[model samples]
Target chain A: MKLIPYLVYLLLIAMHEVIWRDVTAIHGVTINLAAFLVLAVALYKSELTVVWFGFFAGLILAAGMPDRLGWHALALSAVAFTAFHVRERINLKSPFAKFLLMLGGLFLHNVLVVLINQSGGFLYLVWHSALTGAVYTSILTLLFFAFKDGYVTVRKIRDIF
Target chain B: MTWISRLFSRHSRNLHLVAILLLSAVLIYGNNDLNRYVNRTTLFFSWPFSQVRCSIEELSGVNAENQRLQQSLVEASLRLTELDEIRRENRRLRSILEFEPEPGYSLLPARVVKVVGDKIPVSAVVINRGQEDSVLVNQTVINQEGLVGRISEVWPGGAEVQLLTHMANRVAVRVAESQEMGVVKYIASRGMILENFPIQGNIRQGDLILSSGLGGVYPARLVVGTVASVEKPEEEAFCKVLLTPAVSFSSLQEVFILRPD
Candidate 1:
């Protein structure tokens, strides 16, 4: 059962890497599906599991990117760990809270990656790409969460009827 | 000792976080070697997926063919005028001397495999050709329409191209008609902006922009774009000129890497 979830996560990461290029991009900001996945996992899993999963996911992403090698791994791990701790204190069961968490996580990830790589034009990247990416990723996370969990509430209402 | 054991039990998460951070530091320290290995593995894994994407793109091309044909028609018209000028110049040079026009550049065709940061204003695309195909860093990339970008990173089987519109990218360009030189830089919210042209320079809307060959990276006279709008601020020493890229980046599928001889 544990193996199944891990395989699913791996599959999601692989699919994200392949299909993300095709996603509709607005001003070059697309939904960060990988970041969303990390946040989702953190909400449900233990701190240790989330950290390892994030690290591995980041490692996989760094493989395709041309930037510094461990930047993504480090960024993702840090974001996941932060998200896990935040989840313990917050009401992440709510869609709004999840969206907020994802927004912060994605922004942090982008900042870490940019800073680690020492990419120039920091202001332009932050204002144009990072913020837009955070908003877009947050919207995507909300939709995904609703799709995955909203059905349960709908089914319960149907049973009541 | 009991208290120490209790602290470990209660704060194990903190320990794990520290351990991961240390691991991350180690990885960063050995980043160069690890980057090569990771990039190789990524290329190996993503190769099949790239092929699949290519196939899907081909299938979708049927619907896009009409649009491409229309674009080709426009490009053909532009090419005709450019060819006529070249022919006149060649004839004039031939009359003056027994001269053989040097073949300036050769084109290596490559397929775009992956696009990165498309949603972000800072963007790049990965092409199928790499060092094996002699695709080197700083080589100019172009489609039939016009300039696409420049190759930034090259591996064995793949390469990454930093698009001309990327924030960090700057190209030296000149107005074709006026011969006024300027540096084209990508500005956020705004597209490509050509700056540092003299305020008195006669740059106008629809003026063609070409690479000035001032920089060693891109060759001379490659069509970069046209001046979409020009702003002559009264207080500033330079004119702020906005450019509309000749090549449509959103629809780019195939491009040629120019190998200058």
Candidate 2:
């Protein structure tokens, strides 16, 4: 059901918050569940629903982090919308293509957030985010792709029967 | 329909343009203060999970004890030394606290939930006690070993205790043996410095450092650290003194926040 997906999304976001609260990974990646969820769902569903989901996730993220209000909501929606658009242009057939696209989108998201935060020491933040995002998102993108692909295939088989 | 597919493709390209515009507008106009409020609120909501994480972390320590018994014993021995030091420091703090508690001296017991690493210039430990427990800002905290640090910020169910080693932490202390005074300055290469002590003060390498009572935030005479090295120059007006913290903050898992009576 819809509730199950939302719960799973919240759990992942909570887990990310727990692990990487005040700290960034060596390469400067901060785990972002809001972006990850948007990417996962957009790959599985339609554009409009994914956009709405991203907004909700953004709301949850923004609620907790008081430093940037609508910034995240805006960033997440943009990432979801772009991913949906790209899926149609290329053959959404290959898992590698999807993974690559996710990575690219995540990199863009990180860069855009850094620019908004206007955090000093600009060079360090950008390079660190790029390296860290690629590594973390690649691992996550693989798992989500497999899960979504399997679910869709199973649904197709069930419909035929 | 095939016609529907064509129309969708045509508009999908435009969707990217609209998304970018919206994103730029939000970034330009997003309220910074609101974002900070959201962060604070998010932190409050995440408290339950951090508590769970801390409990799990504490459990791992117990599980590690059986596998690393020898290591545990060695740690225990170190703790015993630490306990003795704590007892001596407690007596010193009590004498200082006895003289006159600045204004409101409320004591509370808080357990260390988590120690965030020091990369952020703000090294903090999450304590189980919070606003509900009447833990307030500016209250002095000390372990059995020595003076820890003051409460910088507080939450409803938990609070963050900034450790003595943090870059911004400075304590006023007196040399126990020399009775000479200086402010303890944090040094990157060295642990701490007793800067501006009179050149004539006979400060040995191992002389003890105690709070001078000048800093109202910390009750005077609490053990801060010990002199590690002294820098003396004949031409200079004051000597530079280095101190090693009395409490082994790295291994500190529990501390008692002194209730000023």
Candidate 3:
């Protein structure tokens, strides 16, 4: 497959980690774009491609924190691998099914991140940051999935007009 | 061997996952130097963006800081104005403390309670001291500056002092330098004119006019005013001398009743 696009995706993930993570955060909640992108790749790309991309995305995401790099990379790879198998087993013909999968995946990833980074306040963070972040990211994922498919199209709009 | 190759291909993904896990375990438990390098590199790239972000945050806070500073400025200005008024009052009180009344007359400090007038702002002012304070009618009222007025009416608790600015008020005064005598009276048309003074008196502009003790109403040697101008008309018998009152009548706050010893 093409390597250049994957490199660009990794760069985008790094950009999001450093710049947009805090800027786009609402209150204390933030979007887990690295996990979301990894899950998206698992939905379409091959299992090997998904796992590798997830690993690199994790590295880029946790680049600011050097001590957590290896664990984050491993965790993202595991998430990609699991999501790939789940996609293989589940019938995700509709965008709704894909949206649900994305929501679940993002929530799991957010929980993992909180567990890795936080020294205390596990249950509180799970309720506040992890849950809200998952929901916030899921809404964006749903919109993305809807646009990616022809659920609402330009041609359909022209015909309606 | 062909069976072994198929097994290897099938389990390649699992082996890769295990490898990633081991690498991550190393990063998590050890490799501080590696982590520091990675974090430093990340910060190096993100520094410019973070600077911009900090500036934006500070800019947002500027409006709140500005409003807070403005409020503080207003409070400080009001406090300063109050302090200035207090300082002026303190200076007046200091001068009043140093003031000494004429010999054989004791000074009783009194605050001006109420001022009554139509044209001149304070033609008559009621003092807090009355019969209870031993303040009697015709008693001379003076302040730190000089002669203010004399007690006109006295009640059990309060007394009204007629200021020298009043149309009915008169003070027998003399030129301090020449000792030339004149009766100073207030007229609506011509302010405090020295009357009954000879046209040939050795008086010039800016001569000090003091109470001459002739009327038996006011004491002698008390400063009343300074000679503003002396006009000796050819038709008039006496010189028409104008005087600038030494006491600032409009700002009268404190006064002393000159009671005999």
Question: Candidate 3's C-alpha lDDT?
Answer: 0.86
The true-versus-predicted C-alpha distance at residue B232 of model 1, in Å, is 97
What's the true lDDT of residue B251 in model 2? 65
- Predicted complex 2: DockQ: 0.16
Query: After superposition, which runs of candidate 2 have C-alpha atoms over 4 Å from their true positions?
Result: A1-4, A20-31, A62-64, A146-161, B1-45, B54-261
lDDT of 3 by residue, B5-64 (tens): 897798987777776777677777776887787667656545666676678779879988
Question: What's candidate 1's DockQ score?
Answer: 0.24
lDDT of 3 at A77: 83
RMSD of each: 32.9, 30.0, 5.0
Best by TM-score: 3
User: Which is the winner by TM-score between candidate 2 and candidate 3?
Assistant: 3
Best by lDDT: 3
- Name the weakest run of 10 consecutive residues (lDDT summed) in model 1 chain B: B93-102
| Ranking of all predicted structures according to lDDT, beginning with the best and ending with the worst | 3, 1, 2
Candidate 1 residue-wise lDDT, B1-261, digit = tens = 999999899999787778778767776776566667766775665566667777888878976997899899999999999999889767644543442222788778788889887475547899999999988899888776677789999999999998887887888998999898999888778888998888889999999999998977777777899999999989989998899988777766667888877
- lDDT of each residue in A1-161, candidate 2, tens digit only: 36677756855676666756435454356666667677778787877767766755665565554545466667777788888888878778888898888887777777767766776777777787754766587677787778777844666768999
DockQ of candidate 3, scored on C-alphas against the true complex (2 decimals): 0.43
In order, candidate lDDTs are 0.79, 0.73, 0.86
Flag clash pairs in model 1. A28-B118, A28-B119, A28-B120, A29-B119, A29-B120
